[model samples]
Target: MDTIPAILRAAAERYGDQPAYVEGARAVSFAELHDQVRELARRYVGHGLAAGEPVVVWGPNSIEWVIAALATTYAGGTLVPANSRYTGHEVADLVDRTGATVVMVADGFLGRSQVQELRAASDLPSVRAMGELSRLSLDHRGEERHVREVTIDEVEARADAVSPDDVADILFTSGTTGRPKGAMSAHRQSIGVARAWAELGGVSADDRYLVVNPFFHSFGYKIGILVGLLTGATLYPVATFDVDQTMQLIESERITLLPGAPTIYQSLLTAPGRAERDLSSLRLAVTGAAVVPVVLIERMRDELAIDHVVTAFGMTEAVVVTMCRDGDSAETVATTCGRAIPGMETRIDAPAGEAGELLVRGDYVMLGYLDDPAATAEAIDADGWLHTGDVGVLDDEGNLRITDRLKDMYISGGFNVYPAEVEQALMRMDGIQDVAVVGVPDERMGEVGKAYVVGTASADEVIAFARQRLANFKVPRLVETVEALPRNLSGKVLKNELRK
Candidate 1:
């Protein structure tokens, strides 16, 4: 079961009649999912997609997106999930870079015709556009006798042909630092991470996972879909994170597992009608992608009634390398991300207790950025460590606490300011709900810190409060209140956007 098709076949047999995926009122059983994947595999093969070829599944979170991704593997093709928020130009560029032979996109998502928009923006060069399969009812009459009939055995046999070294996916990096590069990973790598994620999250067959994170992001796709497939859990796909609907789903659907960014939990805890809902069903929570406050974790456990609130640190290139364990202290879960998972090794470049770049090495790391040899060489050094540009520290107990991105560290006067440290300090202050700090140009001192507070605190008051807690040089020179900070689909603060 190192390959996706192998995993799919095992799940179908093991889970049988159990529901594997649920989208609103509709549910797809394991047996049905396997049948549909095989049927679609036939369709894909009929259209000439083969092993090692790329097929871009571009759409939001839905059952169709899931099938499209898995079916590509069943057809022995590589999956390239496009970010739903990508503009036409971005999508076209990605398609071109991947040399994708087929493009399966949602006909309409969130009320917009994405396929039409793509056609309008680019000619799409030489790719086949398959309209949304969200509601596709395949009534294949086996009319094409030339195309071989696909069965579970045949699918498994074909999956066997796809070697562990064959590229399973080419997930593109977030490109916050530079241009987005496709990070290629093999079947073994993908399968390894899937198992590790399930084990770390304590995912079980009886658990019902509410996936508020989009399918395009690694956390949602790897942990959300792959983990469910591996563990035989039921997956509830949530297209967007609406606090009211999510609260209702947790109550009515009896969702036990929910994983997303800190902002999602923050929204749920502070949501208008949250206290009135019966949220006692939530048991496990995983959050990352920003500075997580101790109070947030405490509220998620105490108020929301979630039992295990774990924090993890990962990126697309290297999936869940580190995660807080079940027996970790609340302070450990709150302050640090976690130690490295079983198969991987994590090291920081700086001295112990000092922040430096975090490096990871193991089966979890990607082969390299696709087609960008120089960049790939630079990322994964000769020593076999992937130089994660993220900055963090390894405490005495080996817990990893992320402080800032190497690119995000800014110099102020003669000192360096990690925005995450500044934000964490501001989060502890009263009347501040959320905060993001960025270095702004200051004639007096090369670059000074500017804080964006999402609360009722005034600019002058916040600056004064920070002055008392922080060193004179580290305190923010300016503070501004905003309705909300601009964030990417993954809920990471777009400090680059804030700078503009």
Candidate 2:
């Protein structure tokens, strides 16, 4: 499909009554999903969302989130998804950066009224409309004002106006600069990457896909949601990954396709009473976002009885870059993120068999970072190569093994945590003279943050202070008081020493 709206229309015609999305007690057929998206798009148009404008969707995974995200694109508006784990300050910064006109949040989710928090964080003068995602309808009065009902014809007109080159979503990813950058992807690129992933995984209409990744992430939104849309796979979105709840869903829903970080499969393998859960319906398991052990890959196939188990490597800039193919050996799947997919090219700056910065150029690469030309130029060179900021080695067979990162970022529970951002937040606290953060290996999480401080505050006090400011995954799990951090002659803190 050329665009997301086009995919929605085609899915309705192709899949007809086949189930598209199933959440708890509710399910929507492909046809029904198309109708719902159109209805919601009409409401968005009635609410004064203009073409090319950005709408921020900040919430957990649910059928409502699906509809709202799809409706935002269907209404000719760019989708800007915010991390649900973000505090009001984080969300406000994103909203301000995007100049979002409509901000839809999942109120009362996890016992917090997100809209109120966002309002309390900022005056939000640019936000002309705000509402709870669950209560988004033409007749429902939003926090700011009521929506003006518009006809389906108007919605169709807007959808027809959308081009493949139009920016579909602007996903924010933090950098070493301690600031988040919005990566803009066109409708074609989003659908293109999803289609590529779906083809590689052999996703089909009969497959029941269980999505455990957060919808705000590229893993969930692009590979999970869009892949399902392209392949007609019925999606089962899990708002949170509880072992018992996921196992119950797998048994009840007869889930066939499951993709998540390595930790998810590890949990399922070790959860109490896993054998009794009737997990025979699981056919495919795709995992990444953290190191995947060869033993874990074998266990997922042998213990869980999943027929197809694979691994991939991707980022927010380019959703699915390299992925292990079917029938790949366990070692290959575990140690390497297979060769580049179709429409993409991969190369290392170093000689063959040596590890260097990985570079990629592809049609599915993001358009650019939103409103940041200098940063965009630095990332994607004039030759169209996007410097991935990752150190990797390519073997004779062209398989890529990631070794290290040029950026001081780590993955905690599959979430990208930038140490610079954590250090920036901690420096704001009183009596904190200086700080340095690094990722330490963990048994449960792939990596957790550790902070080395040069200040008078106790470890517990610093941890408590961080809890109120940073997201849970970004918070340092361990703290150490040091007289000073080792620095280079150039006055730069040597992060390698801290990592050691």
CA-lDDT, candidates in order: 0.80, 0.91
Best by lDDT: 2
Look at candidate 2 and give me any clashing residue pairs. none
Model 1 alpha-carbon drift over 4 Å, by segment = 137-157, 409-500
lDDT of 2 by residue, 98-201 (tens): 99888889988888878778878888777767767887643333476666779999899899999999999999999999999999999999999999999988
State TM-scores per candidate: 0.80, 0.97
- Clashing residue pairs, backbone N/CA/C < 3 A, model 1: none
Per-residue lDDT for 316 in model 2? 96
* Model 2 spans > 4 angstroms off: 137-147
